[model samples]
Target: MFKTAKKLFTSLKFNYFSLFIISLVAIGLFSFMYDSVKQETYELHEFKISPKTIRSLKTIEDTVKTEQEKRRIENEVTPFYQFDEEVSKTRQAIAASLFDFIIEEKKANIPDPENPDKLVKSRSEQIEEVRNKFKKLEKEEPGLRLTDEAIASLLTAEVSDLTKMKQEIVSIIGEELSKPVRSEDLSAVRYEVERKLRSSEAVPPAELQTMITLGRSLVVETETINKELTDKRIEEEKNAVEPTRILQGQVIVREGQFIDSEIYRQLELTGLLTNQSSYKPMIGLILYVLFVSAIIYLHFATWRTDNYQKKKSLLIAIAVFFILVIIMKLLSLIDKEFDVQVAFLFPTALAPLLVKLLLNERLAYMMTIVTAATAGIMLLEGFSAIMQMEIALYILFGGVISIYLLGNNGRRSNILRTSLVVSVSNILFVAFYLQMTQSTYDLSELSFYLIAAFASGILSGALTIGLMPFFESFFGILSDMRLIELSNPNHPLLKKVLTETPGTYHHSVMVANLADAACESVGANGLLARVGSYYHDIGKTVRPNFFIENQHGNLNPHDELPPEKSRDIIIAHATDGAELLTKHKMPREIIDIARQHHGTSFLKFFFVKAKELGQDVIEDDFRYPGPKPQTKEIAIISIADSVEAAVRTIKEPTPDKIAKLVNSIITSKLNDGQFDECELSMKELRKVERVICETLNGFYHSRIEYPE
Candidate 1:
């Protein structure tokens, strides 16, 4: 059943379709993460009761509130006004000209002190002439206007009163003109001038009114609103107001609470209003999924990785990816619903552990990064960026630790030890992350996260243990764990060989040691070679007396039969062992080793015996079935098997003898084309010869001489 499934998955059409299906399912699952914040729409109104809570789907600037704040700041800014020195100078000059004209007219009315011949005019006539001249000046300078009564007073008053009026009017105009005088404050300026004139008592009562009227006329509007400066100030203040932001996951409206205008606007701003739908998130999610898919596809398609070339490997990779992604998605949902940090309880190391055990470590490391990235993206909406980073790093580091701790041994104890180490590492990672990111720690939350971390490790180990067998069976994989199980002495096949053919069992054990060491030197699957060696001689148990190893001192069964019968019995063992293994549902690799270890080598003893007896015989008939060793492990086992059997025939074994024998056997196998189907390079073959010689020398080493 498993073989059929493996064959089905291996089909090129099925591989493409399976990848498509996996990608589709992954995108579908991830769509929920992208659309997680699509809350139910509301028909809420201002000052009405809200039926349900509404949260922001994404972070966005609250433009309405921000604009309101900007406007308020702008209104509060004082309008800018600039002082006009030109206006002050002009006003003062006009007032001085008016006063100087009055003084000139007064001087002309009297005779000059130095010139007695100058014409002296009457006071009435002088006042008439000054009024006529001032009237003309007023027409020329609008700001210099004065009433007829003020002008008559200026001319008719005493010289002291005239002097006081001119000085007071010019001083008042200068003082008032120096400061900003807007059109709107012209009345205030006139009243101020009257008060100053009244308080000073500088001018006589008759001329005081004249001074007041003249002071008001001198103080024309000196300051105007500087429109550019006023606008610039408003803009500067408006820009200083920070923008209001509605953060993602912020609650816009709470259930059973009043929905005010602000809340209604927030709901609309965040797209929580009725009939609002945004496809941007969905589009972004599709792009992200495609990117991840493309990365995986590129690794498998372009890289020269050994396992990547196989379709079953692709299936296993996709399977592990789906498992981790789905598990993380479920954990994210649980964390959301429970409001607890259940994300820390995710089986972060499970994907890497399973992949490392079933396939290569490089692919395991790749899956670790992919899994962590997927988890981060899935939880980004629900968690803060710091927390998201923590989760991703936790998965990444935990996976690396698990891969290293798993080693190459897949024993139960080793897995348990790895889980315990992972648990401790997880606790330390959580504590460190929290300490670094959080300003203050909550004891309960920290303890919960730590506990979740420990539980995640334990859970990952438990799940890996439980699922390993299922995956191994489903994929027809011969994992290290399975090889260890098959290598046990108590196994039915090994026990059968031990009880039925003790000598063959002993010989098989020696061959197992030799093959295991040789394959390891050449970087092959040493455990597989050892386990295959254990069951290689199971067929010898069927006719235990016929084979020489199992014959012990019993009469040789081959001596009683014809050489043809003996040759048939010897060649039948290879096929018989293959049949037995196949019937027991053994792994294909072990069965292949059992079937092809001999590589059609000529049984020279049997063939030579037939030739000496003058019996008809063909060279092909003397050889075992010709399906030679097809892998490095099988090829090494074949050489080791022949070397070990040949070495046992040496009466006086030595390291030199064993070395020479190991080299000779490997060279003969090479010349006979037995290693042609296997990928054993010449360098690797040399290493194998040295390792086999060392192992055999150890086994056959002479013991220290002792007194009896």
Candidate 2:
């Protein structure tokens, strides 16, 4: 079962990106199709029955023939189809009859003087008046060449012979019932008459009523026909198709159902589809994963070691980056009234954030690129071309600065501040992008986006915080937490070891100096060795007087005991040291140095004299635990232990004697295989032995007057 599950996970790993790509394409297709139908919702699908199928369908249904599918050529398609024709016909008929009504509608909707008929109507009046005056002029001048001035001159004198005119005229007009006006002044009189005709308030009378009736019929009939056609397709389908004739199926829509070139453009306005996203996601996923992995691969490649720790960190980083992307996915799944392209900003902006805290800046740079590409390809609505490019640029610019300025040396707020600054910078870039694409967007909207970015920044800070401890502990990574705790200057064991047994503490300090120098020169971690030395003999503090160095004013415990008893006391220190360190909860590395520093070295003087006395002394009882020093510090402490003690035994220790003594101690420790488990090579050990010799020689060189 386990094997099967492993194989399943491996398969999921191989083509997970394919699933993502397919899903994105499906969403694009569905959204475009749904939006197209919704926005142009006012239009209806028309179904015209073919002449052949109409009668057959009607005959089958036992009803009159009204409709069938595709019944005629589209020339027969109706007036919303024929809306232009209807408009033209209405324009013509209205001009002949309800001219005033048509003029009002024209004034309301269309641009300046759209109907040419109005101009034609007004011109007709002037044409009729000129012809009438010219005819009268022809009677007077006998030539068709009579000027309009002469025609106008003949006509106005004719109106004065009316009784109505005489009533308005002065009493002097009563002499001939009307006095004739001057013939040359007829132009002014004729203008006044024509002005009254054009501005007349009386409505058009009964003779033009048919034209009004026809115009009204055109509007009403067209509306009725359009409604019929608009509804015909669904109605006919409902009536004609029997349930048994149809296929049983789910509501599956196909690809080209949405991508019709005829209406793709108009469909996009409703927020459905894009021309771009069909295969972009697959491309993006490949690039994103590769880009992120490349960062991990480079850092580890810098070191020659192909160790699991480096590979494990790489795995963790990629997992974290991908997990953040998934979180963004879930966030986008939330319903909002608008497209939050900047929700994408959270993930893009947060990538560097996670990388900076969890990994390094070089990795952060690569991950930022991944973030930008993924967001641009996935989260965005696929309209603006430069969103990915701009976001990427901003992330690099701001994120690199954040890593540089935020050294690995401050409080967590350094990361927080870096996130805040990166988010702000990214928001600014987003705002500029919004302006470039949609030039008329409100500036206040940018304020809201910036605010959102700040919120994301806070979230990024929080996420980095939340994940830090988990990453450190799960990976067993030695990070700032470990460093900070170690640097506390008040670790309990350190304090107790210092206060109770300052002599052993001072010895441990000198050993740390010797070990640190040798460790560093050979390319090992020196600080680790130094810190280890400070606490290596902390067990000696528990029984301070039992050890030689801490027995300042006390008598030697071993002086009165037999040589065998002295050997037992001497061998007991390693075990007692282990016990004391274990009780104090010191690290195992220190405990190992305490217990194994003596290795199986016997009580040399006691074992020799016991043999002379013909007494039986078990050698194993005198030996320390067998697994000796596993590192240079451990082995160095082992040798330093005997060297420090043996040097003190010689009262007049000269430089030559100190060197001889240190060399002999190191050489004896080496020949005994006491340094076998340690990583210290012979060459390095030889150097350590020399350093110990030199350091002790300097201490004893000027103090030669002292004697045992």
Cand. 1 Cα-lDDT: 0.80
Worst 10 residues of 2 by lDDT: 53-62
Candidate 2: regions farther than 4 A off: 1-261, 265-484, 487-489, 560-606, 609-621, 632-664, 686-708
lDDT of 2 by residue, 296-404 (tens): 4555556433244345446566666566656645554451346445553463445665566555666677766655554443343323332345544554555565666
Tens-digit lDDT string for candidate 1 (504-549):
8998989899899998887788999999999887878778888878
lDDT at position 14, candidate 2: 23
TM-score for candidate 2, please give it: 0.44
- lDDT, candidate 2, at 253: 24
Model 1, C-alpha of 221: deviation from truth (Å): 6.8
Candidate 1: 10-residue stretch with minimal lDDT: 378-387
